[model samples]
Target: MEIIEKAPAKINLGLDALYKRQDGYHELEMIMASVDLADRLTFELLPKNEIVIETDSSFLPVDRRNHVYQAAELLKDTFQLTQGVKIYIEKRIPVAAGLAGGSSDCAAALRGLNRLWNLGLSLAELAELGSKIGSDVPYCIHGGTAFVTGRGEKIDFLPSMPQCWVVLVKPKMSVSTSSIFGSLSFNSIQHPDIRGLKQAIEADDYLLMTEKIGNALESVTIKRHPVVQQIKDRMMKYGADAALMSGSGPTVFALCEKKTRAQRIYNGLKGFCDEVYIVRTLK
Candidate 1:
């Protein structure tokens, strides 16, 4: 049997670093929402007891390092399933760009394999299983606007965000999320107004949402890649309603209420950056 799933990309609308825990993991509160851009995962049952991963993009790994492979292996080991499957990923999202592309794929795998193998796992159970693979996998299991806390393992779903066109631009460089977090001086960092952002989402106040959008990790990334800040600056200069770096580094997106403004920002970014996409929020 074969099944297909869509692994959508996510962006942090508001991310704050609360404090470093005794276990060395940083306590975080993040506002995240899935975007229209996504990767497609196609699963087909295999005869032997082995997991196989295939992707056309030479940029991706097809082994256990790939989250899709890890997610499949995890399910097999936990459920003691004898069957195997071949997973083909149609890569649309950018890799290592803080888009949680791999984590979303892992979520897709857990969800798809559940139906394929007839595991009968609930969404919460699957999400708990997925959290072991990556922090973002749990959120991707149910893509929408949410308040995520405690290393991104805790999620509180929010109403769908106001409609807006997002122009995403990624430079031709990959970022290390670990290094970005590593370089952070936790003792001294600005925290985003989480309550304000939440209220804005609840009220469907677009202007307030834009005004309150912030990422604590943005400074560290902008320092490493000045082009990231430059992209934001250009977007704001080109009349984007609001612009900010998505997650860690590299990928920056601008929010606009009108398609003309989104297109203008996209066109302006073409020469400045290699990869640019103009897509609307997924409602």
Candidate 2:
């Protein structure tokens, strides 16, 4: 049997790190939403108990360390399934771009395997399993707009965000999430108005949403990679309603009210960046 899934990239509308926990994870409050840009996953059943991964991208590891393979193993162990599976990932989303490519791929694998193996796991159960894979995996398991807290494992469903064009730019460099967290000086950080952002979204106040847009990690990322700041500046100058770095360091996204303006910004940044995508908010 073959099962296909769409693994969409995620954008953090608001992300703040409150404190580092004893478990080596940080406490965070973030608002995440899916974008139209996605990676495709195709699963094929195997005769033996093995997890195989194939991807066009030469950069990503295909071994057991790969999140997709890990997801298959987790499901097999959890359910005691005898079947093996082969996963093919069409990698459109940039690797390590802070777009949750790996996490989404893992989520896709979990969802695909459930269908392929006749495991009637609920979405909540799948998300619970996903959390064991990665913090972002749980949210990606049930893709949509959400308010995430508690090391990004806890999710609260939010109303669909107002439709808009998102211009995403990924520079030719990858930033390590661990290094960013290690470099962060929590004392100097300014907390974003996460509550205000949530209320604005609830009320459908686009203007207030744009005004309140902020990420506490921006300063930490910008200091390390000035290109991120430059991207944000250029996007704002080119008429984005709000521009912020999505997750940790590199990939920056600009929210535009109009598609044409987003296209303009995308075209303008193409020369400066290796990867640039213009996509609509999935919600």
**Candidate 1 lDDT over residue span 1-283, tens digit each:** 6799999998889988887789777888999988999999999999999999999888998998999999999999998899989999999998898788888999999999999999999999999998888888899998899999897789899998888999999998999887988888877677889889999999999999999999999999988899998999999999999998887867998999999999999999999888899887775
lDDT of 2 by residue, 95-209 (tens): 8888999999999999999899989999889999999989999999988889999988899999888788899999999988888888888779978999999988888888888
The 0-to-1 C-alpha lDDT of every candidate, in the order given, reads: 0.90, 0.90
TM-score of each: 0.98, 0.98
Model 2 misplaced stretches (Cα beyond 4 Å): none
What TM-score does model 2 achieve against the real structure? Answer: 0.98
